[model samples]
Each structure stands twice: as structure tokens, then as C-alpha cells.
Target chain A: MTLQILLNLVIGMVWMLLHDEWNMLTFTIGYLIGMIFIFALRRFFPGRFYGIKIWSIIKLLLLFNIELVKSSLVVIGQITRPKLNIQPGIFKLETKLKSDWEIIMLTNMLALTPGSAVLEIAPKEGIMYIHAMDVAEFKQSIVRTKDLFEEAIIEVMR
Target chain B: MNVSAIIEIIVAVMVLAGTVLSLLSSLGFIRLPDIYTRSHAATKSVTLGILFILLGTFIYFWFMHGLISIRLLLGILFVFLTAPVAGHLVIRSAYRSGVKLSDTSVKDELRDDLKKMKQLEQYHSKEG
Candidate 1:
């Protein structure tokens, strides 16, 4: 828990730096306020941490960026052509991940990627509905993306 | 126009265009028929729009302050990384919820394959 708070602070610092807005006093005050809010929310929700391994999260982040660049180019190409050739469709992807945080992370990752959207999550069936730009090849992509994300996520959460 | 003024103007135009595109995309999301179409609107429009806005910010910071440029780059990198994954998950959830396509859908290969497989199973059971 202490480590998580430290990590959040580091992330916030990085964010502040990127935006070129930094004040030491503001950072400290905001950090404490954020910590308080987090703890208070956690108490109300009463959920367990999935025990994320830092290395696994790093791996996921790396994989996510690589895919993001590739997908962004693909989307750009599709949009720039004289004739649009999008075959959009929804696909159900099964997951072995049982934790809410893991699922949320997976969903967020999908949403961040280009040409894909997470429409719904059915926890009862452990299934995620994803929209792919190229629905014709959705089965393959769905399996590939879900497997890649779920494996890394489950490993981290373990 | 001076170089700085020209750059500023360009950035301003880009930001305006991006905002307009983003608004149009959100409107499409609301107007679209199905989850798949809505996802298309949300993903494509917002991604491009945000990219433009960030680009404007990057240019503005680069010309005006010339500090913390790396951070702006990282911000772009983070947004570039995360937007598509969110769209994928939304589509995934919609599919798992049994969201149906519109009647005008021309081709549904997935449904066709499922139907074919069911027929095959029925035929095999009858043979047994």
C-alpha cells in the first residue's frame, strides 16, 4: 500500500513534468489529498489488491505502446484513402481474469488502442465485447489481443 | 507573418479543427445505431482530435517556453497508447452482451459460421 502511494506520487510527478507545470507545495498537498481520497474510497469499497507485479505491468505497458503505434498507423491509412474500407463488427472475447481491476485495466488498454473499443463487460460469463475496425478478421485479432493482454494482466495481478 | 506568429496561427487552426472533429465524432456516437458504429465514432474521431490538440499544445510549448517539451511528448505518447484499447474493450463488452446488428447489415460471417456449425452438429447426430 505504501509502495502504491509512492508509485502514484511518482506518476503524478511525471505527469506534472510533462505538462510543464510544477510546484512543490502543490505536489505535496495534492499527494496527501489524493492519498486520503484513495484510502477513504478503498474503505468504502472494501476490495482487495490483486498484487500487481511491477515487472509485469512494465511488460504490459511496453506491449501496449508497440500495438498502439501500429494501430494508429493503420487507422490513419484507413481514414486517408479515397474510399473508406472499414468492416466494423463486435466480438466476444473470453478471459480467465477474475479480478475487477484486471478487467478494468484490460478495458482501458483496449480503449486506448486505435481501431478497437470495449463496449461491454459481462462478468458473469467472463466475456468482453470488443469492436474491431476490421471485423472480417476479428476472430483472429480478438483471440490474439485478448490473449496478449489477459496473460500479462493475470501475471501482474497474481 | 513572422515565424512565431505563423506557427501560432497554424496551431490555433489545428486546435479548432480538432475540436470541431471531436464534437462531430461525439455527435456521431450519439446518433449511431449500434455499439459497433458508436465505437467507431468514439474511437476514430476522439483519437484524431486529441492528437491534434496535443500537437497544438506541443507546438505552443515548444515556441513559447521551450521547456518541459519532453513531458508534452510523453503526454502524447500516453494518449496514443491508451485510446484504442478503451474502444476495443467497449466493443468486446457489447459483443458479450449479445448486441445485435441492424437489419440492414449486409454480411454477418460470424453468424453464418455459427449457423453452419450448428447444422453440422445436427447432421452428425442424426447419422449416429
Candidate 2:
């Protein structure tokens, strides 16, 4: 990260000299250029392509937005309807993820999803207490969450 | 109309859509039955709404003015990082304090686990 920032700064400075304007937009463009350079140089560095990880992370973020939009609309539907039949419950989610950081990221992602929040996480047990808005569809949600977010995060972490 | 005029119109529409989503979030906050679900409204919609607004602003500044606002970029990143964490903290505290689940709630697995722990503690105390 530090290396990337240092390289970006040098490129930004060079861009300012070329453009005759030392403003933010030029620097941002330079940063993008520097990032592309670094990404292209990934083969030379060897082992763990941070650029690929960032790409996967961006994909994860896009997936998050899709889930967010769908869930928000679902919750809005629930809110608007007269017959509210929400079956809110807290259930234990045991994840196969080993590291603390991975677990934290998973929990946070779950919190941001449509119908769930992490109430507590017991690392010793490798379980998180997730509160859900609707329990019936939770099985599906859990499967989808694991398939979408967890799988991508594992790729990003690796 | 010119190309710049069309861009301005697009920017205005994005900003308006963002504002409307935020208003819906507030309505959900007020209209939702319980704290747990309300936190969803507070976190998800608000985050997306602000993101839309920021994207519009980013386009306007970057394309029209030929300058980027570092602060705006930072604002988008800051919100993405902190909003969900803040909402999580709020609900976590509420649950820890023994806030009852909504009337519609079916079961609480944690409370059962707490009860089992308490029972184990009583048994150990008796032996000691």
C-alpha cells in the first residue's frame, strides 16, 4: 500500500508538470495511470497480486449493491403492506472462515444485507448471532450469502 | 439542447433520486415496528442514497469543472466504511441490554445459550 501511494504521488507530480495545473483531478488521473502501471507490473513482483484482490473486492462491492437494492425494496414492501408478518429471530451462524479479519468482514457484510444484523460473535465457538427480519427465507439467504459474499471474500483474501 | 445541458439534467435526476431514497429511509425508520429492522433502513438505504448523490457530484466536478474534490472522494469512502459499523454497534448494544424482540419474533437462539451457560455456572458453584 505504501509503495503504491509513493509511486502514485511521483506520477501525480509528473502529471502536474505536464499539465501546468497541480490540482486534484490531474492527480486523480495520474493515480489511475500509476495504478494501471503497478497492475501491469504484477508479474515482476511475484506472489500475491494485490491488483487482482482489489478487482475481486470491487466485484464484491457490486454484488453488495445488488443485494442492497433488492432487500431495500423488499423491506419497503413489508413496511407498506398492512398485514405485517415478519418472523424476526436471532440464529447462530457458524462460518468456516478461520481468521478474525475474515470473520469480521463477513459479519459486517451480513449486517449490511437486507434482513440481518450480527448481534454478537463468539470467536471461540466460531459462531455469530445474526438477527433476521424473516426466518423462513433465511435458509435461502444464508446459502446466497455464502455463495456470493463469502466465496468472493475468500478469493480476495487468498 | 447541448451536450452540457443533457449532462446537467442527468446530474439533477441522480441527485433527486438520491434524495427520494433517503426520504424513504426516514419513512422506514419511523414506520418500522422494531429497532432491529429499523437499523436496516438506517444503514442500507442511507448508504446507497448518499452513494448516488456522491456519484452525481463526482461526475459533475470531474467532467464539467475539470477538477476533482478530494473531500468528496473521502466522504464516499468514509461513509462506506463507517455506516454499517455504526448501525451494527447500535443493534448490538440493544441486544446486549436484553431488548425484547418484536412481537412477531419466533425464537431467540442466543437467549437459550445464555440460559444453558447460567445452568452450568450454578452446577459448578454447587460442586465448589
Candidate 3:
């Protein structure tokens, strides 16, 4: 645990330095303070330090970027065209994911994707109500989207 | 513009775009009629906006320092993990609290399930 704290501090400093936004002293101080908060709450949390599954998270980041790029183009195209061709609707998706962390990950991913938003999630029933700007396309694609992203979350967190 | 100046401009543009998107999403939060609609704005728009900001940061760091540190990656990771969870909690709470939808809302399967459950409860009570 102490080692993890030290590692986090070191990593934080490197991050601050790389960004070239904050001075070294400020970064170090902030890093120390942040680590203290993490250390203090370490035992209260479960699953890898801070409850993050690292490799799975990396995969998610990659997937998110890909989706973002794809959605950006789609959205930009829609904006440029004359007609505002959107079929907006809210749909309920049944998710098999159980943990709070997993559900959160899934919704965030959904929200980030172009033309979709996670309106509400009922964790007790594993249901998520999502609004899609292009509901017709989403309906056709949702199963694949959930299978890809939500399944990854289930594997990582559960 | 010099290479550094151009990079800075690009980063600034990205940041500004992200900020605008975030604000728009917040507006959606307020303007959207129902809890479900509001949540949609809050979650999706915010996530995309944040991603843009992070991407800008990542690019700025890569250009300025010549190396991609794990820390920025971690920040991205943290946002990705927490944003959805927060959305989920809000939605779940809304559902449990009995927030109703607009009349135009079609095909409420969850409501149907709840109705079936109530009927089952009544039947069991009569038998008992």
C-alpha cells in the first residue's frame, strides 16, 4: 500500500511535468496530498487499489477513442447537411452487469459515443434508459454496442 | 506561426471546444423536460466534452514534453470509470422514486413488468 502511494506520487509528478502546466514544487506537494487521501481511504475501498482494473481500463480507453472519432465524423456530417435528420427516442436496455462500477463504466461509454446519452440506470433491475439522437440506427446497433462495451465492463469489474 | 505556437493554438482551440460542449450539455440538463432526458444530457455531453479536453491535454503533453506519461492516462481512466456510475445512480434513484415520463413515451416494458409483479402479489395474497 505504501509502495502504491509512492508510485502514484511519482507518476503524478511525471504527469504534471509532462503537461508543463504546473511547477515541480506544486506538483510534488499536490501529489503528496493526493496520495494521503488515497492512502487514508485505501482500506475502505475494494478490488485493486481504487477499484480500477488497469488492463481493462486501458482497453476501454482505446475503445472510447475509436468510438469518439467515429461519432465525431458522424455528428459533424449531420451538422453540415441541410436537413436536421434525427429521430430522437429513449430506449431501455437490459444490462447484465451488476456492480456499480461496471454500470458506471457502461453509461459513461454510452454517453461519450455520438448521438447517445445514458438518461437513467436502474441498478436493482440492471436496466438503463438511454436516449439516442438517431434512435433507428441505435436500435439496430445497440446489441453489438452493448456486447462490446458492456461485456468488457462485466469481465473487468465483475 | 512557429511549431510551438501552432501547437499551443491547437490545444487552446481544443480546450475551448470542450468547454463549449460541456456548457451546452449543462444547458440540456436544465432545458430537458424530464429526469431521463436531463440525465441523458448530463452524462453523454459531459463525457464527450471531458474526452475532448483530455485529448487536448494529451496532445499538448506529447508535443511539449515528447513523452506520454501514465498520469494523464490515469485521469482519463478515472473519468471513464466514475462518469457512468454517477449516471447509473441518478437513473436508479429516479426510477425508484417513481418519476414519470412524458405522455409520448412509448412501449414501457419495465412498467409492464412492474404491473405483472403487482398482480402476482395480489394473487398470492388471496391464496394465502
Candidate with better lDDT, 1 vs 3: 3
- The CA lDDT at A74 in model 3 is 53
Off by over 4 Å in 2: A1-46, B116-128
- Which predicted model would earn the best DockQ? 2
Write out fnat for all predictions, comma-separated: 0.25, 0.62, 0.19
lDDT of 3 by residue, A44-140 (tens): 6543463255567678768877876565455444444455454556678889888777776677677666666666556888887666655676665
Model 1, span B34-119: residue lDDT tens: 67766666666677678778888888888877755777678767776666566666655555467787543444435554466569
DockQ ranking from best to worst?
A: 2, 1, 3
- Across B1-128, the per-residue lDDT of candidate 2 in tens digits comes to 99789889989998998898888889888777789878878887788789889988988887799888888879978997788899889988897687778888887899878677669889999999
lDDT value, residue A59 of candidate 3: 82
Between candidates 1 and 3, which one is better according to DockQ?
1
- Model 1 ranges with Cα > 4 A deviation: A1-52, B1-35, B48-52, B55-128
Task: In model 2, state the lDDT of residue A148.
Answer: 78
Reference-based lDDT, residue B45, model 3? 58
Q: Sort every candidate by lDDT, greatest first.
A: 2, 3, 1
lDDT of 3 at A73: 50
| Tens-digit lDDT string for candidate 2 (A10-126) | 987898889998798988898788778877876666465466677898998888778877766766666666776678788887777778888878877777677877887778777
Error of 1 at A83 (Å): 3.6
Query: In each prediction, how many residue pairs overlap at the backbone (N, C-alpha, C within less than 3 A)?
Result: 42, 0, 2
